[model samples]
Target chain A: MKRLGYLLGKDMRLLKRTPTIVILLALYPALVAVLVGLAVGRPPTKPRVAIVNQVPENKRDIRIGGKKFDLDKLTKALYENVDGYNVKDPAAALEEVKSGDAVAAVIIPEDIVEQLESSSSQGTIEAIFDSTDPTRKAYVENTIKGLLVDTNNELTNRFTDVSLDYINIIVNGGEITFGGETRNIEGLANGADLIKDVLPYVPAQQRKDLQEFAALSEGAKQGANFAKSLLRRVGQPIKLQNKPVGTNSSLSSLAVAVAVAVSAMFVALLLGAGMLAYEQEDQMLTRLLRGLAPRSTIVIEKTLLAGICALIVGTVMVLAFGAFVDIRWERAFLWWPAIIVASISFGAAGVMVGAASGDVRAASLASFMIGLPLTAAALVPKGAVSDGLYSVLQVINSIFPFKPSLDFLRAGLSPGFDALWPGIHLAILILAYCLIASFAIKRRVA
Target chain B: MPVLEGRDLVKRYDERAALDHVSFVVEAGESVAIAGPNGAGKTTLLSMLAGVTTPDSGSVELPGGKLGWVPQKAAVYQKLTVRENLELFARLEKVDDVFGSATRMMDRIELAHRASDRAEDLSGGMRQRLSIGMGLIADPAVLLLDEPSAALDPLQRERLWELLGSLADSGIGIVFSTHSAGEVEGHADRVIILDGGKLLYDGAPADIGPGAHFELAFINFLRARRAHVNVGGDAE
Candidate 1:
């Protein structure tokens, strides 16, 4: 124990002398935290899309229920609804998309107004999107699709409203103007009543014909009433209400903090391995072994020193992330235990690697090769991988420190934190790694 | 009584024997030099005596059970000051008064003036002295060094030999390996020469070959051993 203290003191003095290493130890995690915080805290940038309007300017208006609706209004809505720019033709818009200046292009046909005016035809809007990058393509596609749906809904509602107005005028006996002539729709319905009243005085064949005409007129009015109700339903069939579950807005920041803390663990591992391997490569291990100190003392000292350095880095990273993002600083009591245990666990594993490798360069390389894959596996979501692969990852997470440490940190950030299981997991890992390190050191010195 | 003894130490690597049934003893206040050609098992012998390597079929006996080892290279921490390095080693050796012993060691190694300087900033000779001082911090009954002066200049080598002479005079046993025949004859009170894992000579330098120069005598001894092997005679 006394020798361990001495070894630790020597390491501290050496660390003080190497300013570059000390600075890097603190700076690396802090930088990672700040960058990740900014990335998650800020809103995403909108993707640019090109709009091609091919409709003729002279015939851009269509009359609906005596109200002039301009086709240019649709184009203006598209521009206001999306981050879009105007292009002259479909080819030019496509070229913009292909050149990476825009993510997608929307083309409105030249005869769109004519199609809207005709009851038998519908307007078609063509959309072209870049598909080289799948994620960007999905985003652009969703944005354009949403705009098209909104436009379709607006057109449907206007058509429904106008149709309902004409139906009311015809069904309830009113006058309407059409093609420079005013006609009383009530007079046409009153003719059926006149026919019915005169049916008894006419000849037998003529009276039968009059009775059929009067029934047909009454059926038309009832049909008009049914169509008006159907049109109202067609305008809006389903309504959606959005309600999010959690009130915590700092979830992204918490995730960034966890990621930065995990990175700090890796830094601790590399530092511990490199420092121990350097002792051997520099021939200091031989001299150290010649002293009365036990081999376990050296391993423990290295593990503790590495852990302390990494803890400092992790603390700095958490604080830096908090500056950029809202973090639950009150949960630091819970976070400290997790960070301390995880740092020491990884540090002990690093010392084991160093002892087995017995060379500084080899130890550092091995640390990265082993740590990166394990950390990646641990961090991968269960839904992202197949069942078999996720099962294997679960086993790795149970044995390694990365997953448990991440979980501990996430729990600390959460509203309700339970420290029992994660604490036990980290304790087991630390013990196992320290034992392995001790064995390796003894074998190396033997 | 002998301060250290090795009884027929034999160490092998796969098909080659690094140390073949080697045996020796060091008395207190004695300075012994192990002289040999390349791959002659000098380091293997010193390593076994220092307890750094275990012989496959032999035992090393040090009644006091305290040994100090200085490896081929200067093994002191380069980032630490000379005084810091000495004090650290003293503490690691579990000395009661770490600072006092470290100060004494600095003066003994003649590095007290540069005690505050980092080992990396020191001259090669100063670093070597610091290495030796680390070895002496424990005040062991026997000290073993492997090629301690291999990289030193002539003047540095002379000063190292002077330090070793004084240590021996202070009643500590020292065993060091070297390739220089002059070091074997001039500095060592006794010499042990090995070749091809076999001991060629073990006696006073003057007694190896009467009236022959020590270096020539050493060469002729090796030639005679090869000739005996060529004639299919026993080499033991």
Candidate 2:
């Protein structure tokens, strides 16, 4: 229809004439990305750990194949091996772990060499661990555990395959030594990593053994016990400003996405409200209604204008995301349609306000109503949100094309969302919005 | 046959009637002027005839002719230059290269030098003339002008009269509404008078009777009627 072309042409012309609008559209993505960067964002890093070497001063010299090593040497090796982490000492080290400074702790056995030569199971080599920080603790435990095992295997050949016997020694009436020589206190040590001395890496607190007092059934709750202990140590309401979800390399991206979705929908609502409101204010609507030019022309033109603006904005956002956030654009082909649908759908809603309000100023009330709630999607993650609120948001988002487009963009960015579904989302958004906009047009005429 | 015919047309706003059983017809190629004071419904009638508003009760019958309408305000895009406004209208009306026509129309109105200025920046009289130029852009069989002579200087007014005379000579049926008796006396072929939503006179220019002082006269009549309603007294 001539009306349709008229509207489309006018919108196209406006876009061509206005350079400011072009700039506004372009900055949308970057602005949102930067905003999200401010909230819950930080750089990538490894865990810091502290080691306490309890070996005697002489026995600290533990030997391996052609490698004479001491606790200090292994500590140095661990430091050199790991990246982005520092090995700190007892006095200054783990103030972070104790004051929640270090992620984990490592302690080496004193008679480590003696246990390796004894060939038997008289005494055990050991290490005490702080289970408070799993990230740091896991790394310390694995490295020490693997190294001791290798040392134990090498020690078996040193005795020429003799029937495995052991050594015992006494000190202060305590059976400090067992099975063999009154030997070097060093001979009773284990160069090996395992230690029944492998006390279950427990926190320094909660020393009450379950075997002594607590219900056997209570200790039976394996994972629950760990959780209860950890909760007590950490207290409630844990918070970290830059906790990065495994899926995102940075938390800032999420914030940026939320802002973009919120703003785009807002602009859409405003555009729609202006359609009829402007005419009514200027008495143009009355002139329009009486003219032979027909009412459909006005609606079509407004819708087209909104669509064009949406395209420009969406394209700019897509480009910015690619440049700064490392977004994959090849898969972004579907974003175009989604943006268009959202633009027109929101624009139509705006027009509805204009038509209903009778003037531009009156349309502001409707803009506020539609925009505020729709912005919630930008504020909270879908999964973290309560089920009831999420459902309500989903329904509200369905009311406009912008909602679906934003959803698709986010879904596309996140892992596990297939490209096909986002494309489908975009299609539905465009078709549904255009239909809704057409209905809005019809209402304006009526 | 009449170029435009309406029978007992009625338009109601909420509970009150704006045009109550109004009837009129204009012959082809005739320049008719609608005369009325404020609230006399002169605008309401012109708007209806322009096809911008529809009658609730009566129907209008037009026999195979085009209509061009001009509103009272400038109604031109302020951001656009004069030449731009014309081309926009021309394109909107689907006329071919309406550019040439717009150029000629501008020269006729003596606005050729000011053609490059935005419609908003123009003087009030220039803006009015530009609005007229827009109405005549399509050069339809029927030209509808609402308050055409409003806010025009003497020279501009004379120029507008000459333009209307030329349009009438071209056999374009021109219908204009005005509160000015000078327009009706000097130019119009006939005059139709409306008073308080009623047709008080519908005939030749000579048939206006003695009511050239219409706005003052109508206000007095309304005042007297108001007094009669308040205090039981004879009125009229």
Candidate 3:
């Protein structure tokens, strides 16, 4: 054990003296974590859109039942939600987008009002956006589509009100006979106010019927108001309430997992190939063997160094994630086990490679060849792939240490998260991998 | 008993014999130099004797005590300071008070002034000295070196011999393999010549005569041995 300490200390001193490689290795994962953290699930900035209104100038005046309406005024009201710069010609609007003056161009259809009035068919609004800023272009396109949606909603509401008004006019203009007394139903909307005043003068049966009628009228009026209000809000139903379990978003958690996995791999490989394999490459191990130290001592020292390096890199990645991403560390207990398990597992793997290959370059190359695919399997969004591919990926993911670690992190970082059973199972899985690797390494060294 | 001995040692690589039935013995306080041309099994024999690798069909007996091996290539960790390297080796050898031992070893190797310098920053002579110091850290009864002064200048080689002489006087057995017989002729008490994985000569260096170039002597010895083998094959 004392000899092992000396070996580890020697390696540490060597690493300290070679500050360039040490610093580079330390910063690699941290920088990657920050970059990935900042990028995940963040919405694109709003884009500037150039608008071209093509409805004829003379057709701007819209008349309905002798009431004059300005089409431009209505369009302008809906366009207020968009960051639109009005241009004279649709071609000119597209030219502005091409010139990088705007991210997108939206041209209102030429016969929009005519289509709406004649056939009730909505006219399409043509939009063009720069491909260079795809995210911003998509944002602008969605915004414009939303504006058109609002215009259609407003038109529908106006038609509904007009229909209601006509119904009200006809009902008021006619009369209904109740108990041989003809009463106008147009005032039914205010019947509750009228009934209280007339209750004393009416007979019991008549009074009861009037009270029922008044209640029915009041309910209908309320129901109509409710329908109108509901229609106004109908476009945006099912509001998404973002309830994050931890400080990190789902994307941020994924980023953390990937960063941790890669960093753990780097640390392990570096220790295995760079520090442990150096002895063999330089024939120092043979010397040590001839000396008092046994092969088991070499194994112990290599494992210890790899483990320490893995822990350092993993911790740096996690801390960088926490700093760049707003991850709630209060529930960190849930996720920390994955990091620990992954670090040890990778470290053990590194030692195995280092011991077996006895060449630093070979060990490093093998580590990367194995690690890259494992990381991808662990971190790639399972939903993005086909069901069949995802199933296959799940199987592949199960084969590597990264998958269980990533799974534990994802579940642990989710909202309303409980039941650490899955995490425990995954921890055991990683532990099994680490144990197997350690045994292999020990055997190889011996 | 001799401090170290090997009997009928055989080593093969890919069906080709590196060392064939090679045998030697070294007593305490003696220095033996294995002289050979390229591919003459000098390193393979040393490796087997050092117990770094096993021979195919024979045995090597090391002293019932510590042993040290220095490969042809200097194997000190370049990133570590001279003292740090010594300290690590000392600890591995279970030396108590590793720091004190390391400092003493550094002073003994005449590298005390550069104890803090990284091994890579040292000159060839200094690096070789440190390598030897690492080998001495185990306090081994016998030490094996493969071309220890291969990369050193003449002055450095002389200094190394002087150091080895003092160590020999202190009762340590040393076995070294070198391509240059000229360098080992006066320093080594016994000189063993090998050719084609077989020992051609084993005797004191003075037996070759005072004025003979050791290289020419070695070459002549190999040619005569090969001729004798060829003549015996024809008689058979």
The candidate that wins on lDDT is 1
* Per-residue lDDT of candidate 1, residues A93-202 (tens digit): 98999998988899888888778877788888899988889998888889988777767777888788878878887767677777768787764356567777788899
* lDDT tens readout by residue for model 1, B82-192: 999998888778888989999999999999999899999998888999999998898988888899999999999999999999999987899999988889889898999
User: Which segments of model 2 are wrong by more than 4 Å?
Assistant: A1-3, A14-30, A33-259, A275-292, A357-369, A377-402, A415-446, B37-40, B149-162, B179-187, B195-198, B211-236
Against the true structure, candidate 3 reaches a TM-score of 0.74
User: lDDT score, residue B151, model 2?
Assistant: 68
Give one clash count per candidate, in the order shown. 0, 40, 3
TM-score for every candidate vs. truth? 0.80, 0.62, 0.74
Top DockQ model: 1
Candidate models: Cα lDDT each: 0.81, 0.60, 0.73
Ten-residue stretch with the least lDDT total in model 2 chain B: B227-236
DockQ of each: 0.47, 0.25, 0.39
The regions of model 1 sitting more than 4 angstroms off are: A48-81, A84-111, A115-149, A152-250, A416-418, B8-22, B35-41, B53-58, B193-201, B205-236
Please give, for residues B1-236, the per-residue lDDT of candidate 3 as tens digits.
Answer: 47888899888777777887988888888998998777777887887787666678889877646677888878899988899889888877778889998998898899999998999999989999999999888788888999998888999999999999988888889889987767677789998877768776778876754346766666666666777763121100
Error of 3 at A78 (Å): 8.2
True lDDT of residue A273, candidate 2: 66
* Model 1 chain A lowest lDDT segment of ten: A246-255
Chain A: TM-score in each model: 0.79, 0.48, 0.66
Ranking by TM-score: 1, 3, 2
